[model samples]
Target: MTASLPVATQQDGTYPRPQLMRGAWHPLDGQWDFAFRDDPREAPAGVDFDDTIVVPFPPESPASGIGDTGYHLVAWYRRRVTAEDIADAGAAGTGARVMIRFGAVDWAADVWVNGTHLGSHTGGQTPFSIDATDVLDRDGDNELVVRAVDDPHDVAVLRGKQDWLEEPHAIWYHRTTGIWQPVWLEVVPETHVESLAWSSDVPNGSVTLELTLDARPADELDATVELRIAGELLARTNVRLLDRTTEITLHLARQRNGQQYEHLLWNPETPRLIDATITLGRGASEVDAVSSYLGLRSVQATDRRFLLNGRPLYLRSVLAQNYWPESHLAAPDAAALRREVQLILDLGFNAARVHQKAEDPRFLYWADRLGLMIWGETASAYEFSERAIAALTTEWMALVRRDRSHPSIVAWVPLNESWGVQHIASDARQQAFSRSISDLTRSLDGSRPVISNDGWEHAGSDIWTVHDYEADPEILAHRYGSTAAITELFDGFGPAGRRISVGQQDGGQPVMLTEFGGVSYIDQDVEGAWGYSSASDAQDFARRVGGIVGAVRAATPLAGFCYTQLTDTGQETNGLVRADRSPKIPIEDLRRIIAGD
Candidate 1:
């Protein structure tokens, strides 16, 4: 297994955005005064303080010190930011702005500083920032207040696996109400780089960088771009920033031959990253600078196989729920996030279908460093309505804008199990919605394939997939054994008694057993513990797992496969590892089977 690169710093000072690194930032992830109120007050000016809860952990989790599972339609949080903290963030100087960024706040959130209302954001999952430069009291304590509202029964909202009931049941788990991720402060110049996007052309050995600036430049500014590998400078160029957005392409020096490309191209075997440094300058003095990295690779779904760098690479993947017994959606710590990536590689999988939730960026960073492919997925809204469409489209697109720079994300799964468009099989409007989303995803980023709706009843997809829990190896092999059977299965019913192809499918696209082999195993029976197929003991567990995975590997028409899950989340016990992350059997035994040896 490839060792994961150590996180650069601890949680208190961890750089949340690893690809784009800045030196001036301060984390706001400690104790905060919290209270539950769905009252008439818009802000928390006169509200009484009741309890203290940890930042970045929702009130539902035990880690937050308040394990409230009931419906709290509205929640309030307040914290005092000292002048020292602002100065430490480097935002107190002239022409510098202090931006308070929230990793995420559920449903909707309204922010206020010193009793002045800044604004409100609607998306629950995506990150947001507010400039507190004007309202912040630089010499004294600045009271920052936030009001969060996450309606427990709002099915129109994209609530991934968060169960709405009082207790978790079936596939759903506990709710993560408010502030489940980090909050931090950063200082930036008036004209600074906002974000960057990279696109690599492997055949030409050139990478194009699209840079977005914070504001329009009053005068023409010059910028210098540098690319390095292993601390060795590979390419350096100068670009003129006449507009707020600019593009520059750099042709790498040593990627002229197949052998050189093999050594430097990003793959699970050789995950080479070219470090980048961008400096914005006004004549001679440096205005702003930041550090980032890029991975030169390409992915496509073509000719019945998933291609990585124009080569057929079979995807040995597991469905990563990315949940924990303690932290629900958030990682217990930075180290635990790294361990999750390492454990996936140790189990002999090259890719992961990060199911449901749009995962933390830190997890994506580890995957990029350790060379694991990811099928990026987003949470889904259960009901089909105008509100659901607007909510899902807005947040899902924002998620794409935020995460498109990560090289480890090879594909995008906008919806799963036909969650939002449940009636796509028969309804035309839902079917149209599914197709439009797939088209939109392709339009935004054409570098990778997009699965419109996973599982059966696909409206449109680049690679056709199916979810079958057929435990018998012989039956499973025969089901996907022949090309004729494989071709016919798409036009007919699938294992779930739903049509494999509904609206549209590319004739030459890849066909993979993306999801299967969910055989539940445990020491003994516990309430609500179940699987499609059960194993009685260790011997049976190994046999069932080995047989199911081997069956998929032996099937000639199958290009790839993803096992049921990576970990046992909530009530689901079909994971390869236990909920506490203990190996049900020896790790090596499972690795051998998963690797098809």
Candidate 2:
């Protein structure tokens, strides 16, 4: 069945980078020349493009207008760039450096600007850029070509839930090939802000900001960083840029105009954000400036509870795959993204465990703005190999660096359900690798909690998370009621049976039922529709959901619970909402069950 378009179309000219905004920019969206080939050889100069695909949408998606689900190992895209695009870029006496940024492209991507070879990027889920200033022809139209290659079956590649078979089965869906996010061009000065790292100390009421510049000090340049709240300047500092990076701390607890100020903390209820402006100047002349914002919040976990901003917080979350029937991984528009978050909130969910895929930055931006918590997870590969390990680690690090600044992301989940490291319980090296990754994440950012391997055998995890699909609520409550019940439940277990609870039991750590209640409901008689358990009708689905969630909530020691899913995708007909986002059960009924009202 073909899916209908969303109510609102995505704005064509909306800047892709919302965290850091600059004035001079152009979107490279819309239609682009596309061609499919079997080999990865360079495109022949005279070859004619046979098809057109929409930018930011994968070829396999209906939104791309090219519903080619067949695997194409190599795909090429070409677009024309006119000189008029960069006319107003170099206006401030500073030489303009034009950079073409790709929000995300699947697997591997190589680029050429005016036939000049630019760089290539490997990961499919993170953003990357190519400096096009040197190669673009300012007088005439320039040719831009991109070649992307993806092999979904390759165990080394992190394909997430994209099935390798011709048709999707089980939890896996159709593959997303080529570009899946918006492409745009940005104009910046010779030396610009490359990235910003943030950390907040809630108890001390202060925040530290680390600014990384594109280049080292070319001359004696002074950098000024200012923090403001609702247009009232809180603090400002100036530093001499002698290196590539500088760090500044802004103490929120201070006296301003002989009056004391109280620290405003960010929570799911009130996600307060403070604005920031960074300026680089040579002597008295301003060379570069950028605007950004940050939320002052802290996430910590004690033995028995999860703490947000130093207060005990309970998570009512849903598993969000972030997929659509028409758009596959990409949301049809920004409005659809907002609608999804609103639906989650309306259904009484405060957080989302983003399943498998690393969601779009725009979605995260909304989460930060709308006061929703997120459990950031990496897309895990199925095979265990050196190549897979390296690829997963590299991409996981990139994901961390790309998203660590967002205050909404309270936890980092590196692995889920032992997807890639199946032998982690028996293999020492695999266990060590898991510990290394957990340590690495903590070292990179010590502010948030890290779950090395979620769901079952966890070696190094701050929060002990488990996934149980037992449909009976009585059994679930009996099993998780007390510390003795958990101990006796897994006593004298072998390696295979101990997959659910490996290592020594720790009651001090926060316990969470991360995955449960995948009760299915089929409105129509469709083949291959499945879930953990099937319900006959809407009332039956609601009853089963209430039983499962109510049971988990009655287990008082449990910190939180994440329902199976937010919406249906592919054959997984267990979501609260249908594949097209229509509610399978009444919203109020589901909310009452989820909120334990």
Give the TM-score of each candidate: 0.96, 0.94
**Clashing pairs in model 2, backbone N/Cα/C closer than 3 A:** 303-508
Q: Write the per-residue lDDT of candidate 2 for residues 1-597, one digit (tens) a residue.
A: 001111111212245666676656777888999988877766537446799999888999999989999878888899988877666443333576888899999989999998888989998898999999888887789989999988867877888888989888998999989899889877778888898877877666677888889989889988887777766787888889888988888776453322332245678887777777778888887778877777888888896799996778999999999999899998887677778878898899999998999988778777877888999997888888998899898999998988898889999998888888888878888888888889999988899998878777777788877788889999889877787755564454422365654563564678888988889998876558899998998888888988989999888778888999899888999999998888887888888988866
Model 1 alpha-carbon miss at residue 448, Å:
0.2
For all candidates in order, the CA lDDT equals 0.85, 0.81
What does the lDDT come to for candidate 1? 0.85
Worst 10 residues of 2 by lDDT: 1-10
Give the residue spans of candidate 1 off by over 4 A. 1-13
Best by TM-score: 1
lDDT of 1 at 550: 90
